[model samples]
Target: MLEARNLYSYYGKSVVLQDLNFDLEPGSMLAVLGRNGVGKTTLLRTIMGLTDRTKGDLFFSGEPLGDRRTDERAMMGIGYVPQGREVVPRFTVAENLKMGTFARKDGKRAIPDKVFDLFPILKEFSERRGGDLSGGQQQQLAIGRALAMNPKMLLLDEPTEGIQPNIVQEIEEVIQTLNVEHGLTIVLVEQNIDFARRACDRFLVMDKGQVVVSGRGEDLNDEIANKHLTF
Candidate 1:
């Protein structure tokens, strides 16, 4: 559902992503793996039009995305859960989720039952402030907020990062369900190789802002990890 060719993304004068290339098919999961500062996060940001500028071509569902603004892309059905889980700290759980619906083309303000179903804790704490939640709960809230938009695709940046073990597993299962059962296309920027290998059908490794290795999930073996993914 997403394609990039010779993509270069920049923050002012410094180019953060250089000549990146990838294709994400509909109803499939693609893993983006790389060590710290290799431009994995920037790839997602570029797709969302958060960067200062981008060069080359980016397409979503056969339409050119370079000219589309950030909110326009959201209306086009791309959901982004950035690395920091940037929920409004003052907003209640319900309010935070409602914010996502602002991007919906349908103009519906109702939070999806599917979102509450995936993360039951969100429903339980609907009135709690976002800042009052634990790290795992906040991550859940982040994902739930994105789902509230009823997006066609999800871009997740380290959804498991800093989360406790139990919630990590829960979050992983939710990601699996979203892709396998719900058929939401995913572009995941993840640090966990094992989970990525199991959950993704396609995988790519990047270094220095460019794709260094890419293939089917089975090709993401230890050799490739040691060579391109090790810290």
Candidate 2:
């Protein structure tokens, strides 16, 4: 289990997350929902230790991840796909996926064939420059790179943002397969309730740096989801 208790975060003294608490079970998906600028990304950053946690404790598999560096956390099975799909623009698709191998501790040098099975387009575009791919393809590459780590837990931010409908559906299916088929835990920060509704087994709704509502999957309060998440 991954637990965040009374968590808090800030950007140059402007508090972004406040006393946020949540838990994700193994092989399950938790969706973090809110409108833009509600500190959803900050929460993911804090979990990955990319942002400082001013208060509270982060426990992964019952071990506290206090003051751990970002790379250290990745080594400990925390994988992240930041909002911008930060693929190395100059690197080929294959090269970008290789970057995730560094997160593995067992000295496994080979990229698993399963990764290629998950995102077959990457194999086809193995030699293509990351920057040359369309936005949706780049997003697939980003997720594929994160998968290369073979992480037990995955964090994604706004993966469907600016993506085409078909690509969005593909991402959603990937999220489901990761949880059900592979037993991978996922914490997703998404703006589209439709996608979240289909992919996540539970959700946490944040506003003004606080989780104001949470519940089982699409079981979230529709009125609140509409009021806070919809523009």
Candidate 3:
């Protein structure tokens, strides 16, 4: 559903991603794994047009996304949940979710019922301020907010970071459901190798701003992890 060719990304004068290339098929999940400072986050940001500058080709569902503004890309059906879960702190849960629908091409503003099904807590805490929620709750809210956009593809940066183990499992299950049951294309930057192996159809190990090793999920074994991922 998405393709990047010879992708290079920059933040100001410094290049952060170099010659990155990958393809994501419809209804498939790709796990991008690397140690810190290896440009994993930049890959997602570049895809969303959030980087300072980008070079090379980016195509979504066969159409080239050349010089498209961030909002335009959202209208094209890409939802991004950045590393910190950047939910609007002061907004009520419902309001925050509603904000996502602004990017919908159909101009519909209502939150999708599937979002509530994936995250029942969001419905329960609809009236609560986002800033008052616990970390795990906020992460769920972030994902639900992205889902509100009715996206075809989801770019998640470290969705399980800093969460409790139980909530981590919950998020993992949700990711799996989104890919398997709902047929959403997913590009996940994840640190948890176990969850990546369990949830992803394919895995890419990046180092020094490039994809070093990538293959089907079953091929991401101990040797590759020890060589490219071990800290």
Candidate 4:
């Protein structure tokens, strides 16, 4: 449902992504893995129009997304949960989720029943300020905010970064259900190897700003996973 061909991007004067190519099938999960500073997050930023692409093409749902603004991309069904979980610190959980639907073509806000079901913690803490939540709860709130957009393709950057292990497992379970049951297309960038392998269907590894190895998740052998991911 999403494809990047020969993508190249830069931050100020230094190039961070070069000739990167990958694809995500509709309703399938694709994981981008590597140790830090390998362009994993850069790839997602370029795709989302958050970073400028010097060369190459981006296509979503078979339509070219060349030179679109970030908000335009979000309106087109590309929802992103950035690496830091970038939630509004002062906003309540419900208020934060509401912001995601601002670009909906439909006039009314479309809150999916499944989103609340997937992250029941959101309902329990609906009125709590985002900054007051635990790190794991903040992460869930971030993902929940993205889901409120009803995106056709979701781009998640390090969903398990600093959460406790058990909470990471809970997040993983929700990711699996979103893909398997809800048929949400996902392109996940994760540092946690075990969590990525368990939830995604394919893996794309990056090094020095380019994709170095890629294969089915089931075939993500120990050598590559450990070599490319071990810190």
The lDDT values for all models are 0.94, 0.88, 0.94, 0.87
In the range 64-165, model 2's lDDT, one tens digit per residue, is 887788889899988899999999999999899899888998868678888889888999999999999999999999999999998989999988889999
* TM-score to true structure, per model: 0.99, 0.96, 0.98, 0.96
lDDT string for model 4 (1-231, tens) is 998898789888789999978888899999999888898888889888777546788799888887788898899998899998998999999899898777565745867788789899999999999999999999999998888888888899988888988998899898888899999999999877777777779999999998889999888888997787777
Candidate 3 lDDT over 7-60, as tens digits, reads 899999999999878899999999999999999999998889999999899999
Task: List candidate 3 stretches off by more than 4 Å.
Answer: none
- Per-residue error (Å), model 3, residue 66: 2.9
Give the range where candidate 4 is weakest over 10 consecutive residues by summed lDDT.
103-112
**In order, how many clashes per candidate?**
0, 0, 0, 0
- Which should have the higher TM-score, number 3 or number 4? 3
Error of 1 at 200 (Å): 0.3
Relative to the true structure, candidate 2 reaches a TM of 0.96
Best model number under lDDT: 1
Better of 1 and 4 by lDDT: 1
Residue 17 lDDT, candidate 2, scale 0-100: 90
Tell me the tens digit of each residue's lDDT in model 1 across 1-231.
899999999999999998988899999999999999999999999999999999999999999999899999999999999998998999999999999999899999989899988998998999999999999999999999999999989999999999999999999999999999999999999999999999999999989888889999877899998988876
